[model samples]
Target: MTKHRVRTVERYTRRTRWYHAAVYITVLALLGTGWWLLTGREGEPSPAARLTGAADVTLHTYAGWVLTGLTAVAITLGARAARTFVVESVRVDKGDLRWFIRWPVAVVTGRFSHHRGHFDPGQRVANLVLVTLLAALVASGVGLTMVVGGPGFVWLQRVHRWATYLITPVLAGHILIAAGLLPGYRGVARAMHLGGRLRVDTARRVWPGWLDRRLAEDDKQPARAEGDSPD
Candidate 1:
């Protein structure tokens, strides 16, 4: 096998890596308990509830709070940096449009590609939806837990349930992509776990436009300095 030249590129900041871990872990906790809570109740214990016992409800409730706290902390700590990430990931352009149309088809057909993106358009859009769902879940969960029976508190519970229904599948997809189960994606988890360094070749494939732009800037720096130097 021919060896390709490799480089280490900074992919995620320390805070970003930790925050991502916290969010996913908390979300997973919330989902697990939430599923059991949804299926099983005091009088009518579903299989999940039967297996887990009374602890599931308690766990579910606390998990929601934990999720809320983690999300808030992430925002507080990373808002400034997050703005850059959001801009890079969420912005739609011609490349994103092209990638989305072909990429979705490719994924479904089992002919996948590591197409260009700062963040893949599909992932960016899906993340936006998930974020919106998370906000709804947090708000409704707080209303249900804190109010606990005030006017429309049942409605709050309803909203939270609905939001979670949407969140569950989307989260599953996100995990598949991160786990590298999705075709053409060999998981992006390494950056979050292993010092946030991305393999330059992989980064180039997935984020070619961003890589190119950065490379262009790098190239210009020497030229700029040379022009500035006294002849």
Candidate 2:
């Protein structure tokens, strides 16, 4: 009998995985408390607020603070990675339009168009939109915290509310895709969780350009090492 072997690729570093976990947890907490408070439930404590012995407003405020701290830490400690993320998210490839056109069908069929980038066209657009919305939320939240009552406070509140409204659906779609609920995205959740490793074939199908570059770099290692070795 022959044994079957499967190859895997490292999709995220430990730090990146940890950072992602922190951000999502904080964001979810903020959303839950924010929504509850928004819907005339500020007088009633949420489960988390009751558990923590804090008001919903307090919990939401602290969650925002945690998110802010996390962002600062990521920026300070992972500057290069942050820059790379922004650069990759903003880049456009020649095939991106075609990829976007095919994406709707591909979601159900599990067939995607080929493009050259770290992120697919859909992912790049998602990244940009998500980041912008999150930034707006953060900035408006900070303004709300600082201002007691004025036109500025009202404006900030409007921005914060609108950002939340926009981000909720966007985040929902992101979660659906990232969770591998879509046929085309099967196995993609492993890239950020389950030890941040992905099956090589899955990575090839979803991120062919990234996989190709990674493999090319890997192929150069042996030759480079041999050249550096002393006789």
Candidate 3:
């Protein structure tokens, strides 16, 4: 007799995927444009830098508009769900505290292991802070870019400049956190590299309640003898 294995179906909604991809790509473009604007070389800019810089900065401006549009769409389509994610991610619970303590202990002893479920309370808190910071950064950046043409307050300009500097460390810490979860997180990176699809396990782990239910269902079917029929 052959034994059947259960497979889980886990994935992001197409709209959610679109939202994440657009935000990240535009973020990279914004970073590139910001780098050039801050640290352009003396004399005429190199053709490569000139073209890339112009294209990216333009894209970044429009991308901010796109992000605003997407945010509206998300609120419309899944207002409740989005709000729940926002709330849960921001709530610093006892679990997060425990996780924090365990993480360092595990790291020191070379036994770093974590629960295999959805984002922990700590991760949710970090994600919420990151998203809020990113939104503020984008808003300030848009205003700063329009300074030449629009109303630009000196203090606002300085705030935008300092925001970029501060956000760099936050972004670095985010990357380091992901790296620490590489065993589970590598596929999130791969999903982009492969254009959305990833190993099923990765998706299940990333979105446990949403996708892992299928696996649970798979496990509950009763085994039958070779010739037995359903009653």
Against the reference, the lDDT scores of all candidates come to: 0.69, 0.88, 0.56
Q: Candidate 1: misplaced stretches above 4 Å?
A: 1-5, 41-54, 105-117, 214-231
The TM-score-based order of candidates, best leading, equals: 2, 1, 3
Candidate 1 RMSD computed on C-alpha atoms after optimal superposition onto the true structure: 7.4
What TM-score would candidate 2 get against the native?
0.93
Decide which is better by TM-score, 2 or 3: 2
Clashes of each: 1, 0, 1
lDDT ranking from best candidate downward? 2, 1, 3
lDDT of 1 at 26: 79
TM-score of 3: 0.65
78-196 in candidate 2: lDDT tens per residue? 88999999999999889899899999999888789998889999999999998999999999998898999999999999999999999999999999999999999999998999767
Worst 10 residues of 1 by lDDT: 222-231
Q: Which candidate number would show the highest TM-score if scored against the true structure? A: 2
TM-score of each: 0.78, 0.93, 0.65
Cα lDDT of model 1 by residue, 1-231, tens digit:
955544545566687778888878878878877876687653555455567775667767777888888877767876787677667667766655667667766554534344445676787888789878999998888888667576698788889889989989898888777765655565355556666656655556566665666556656432122113222
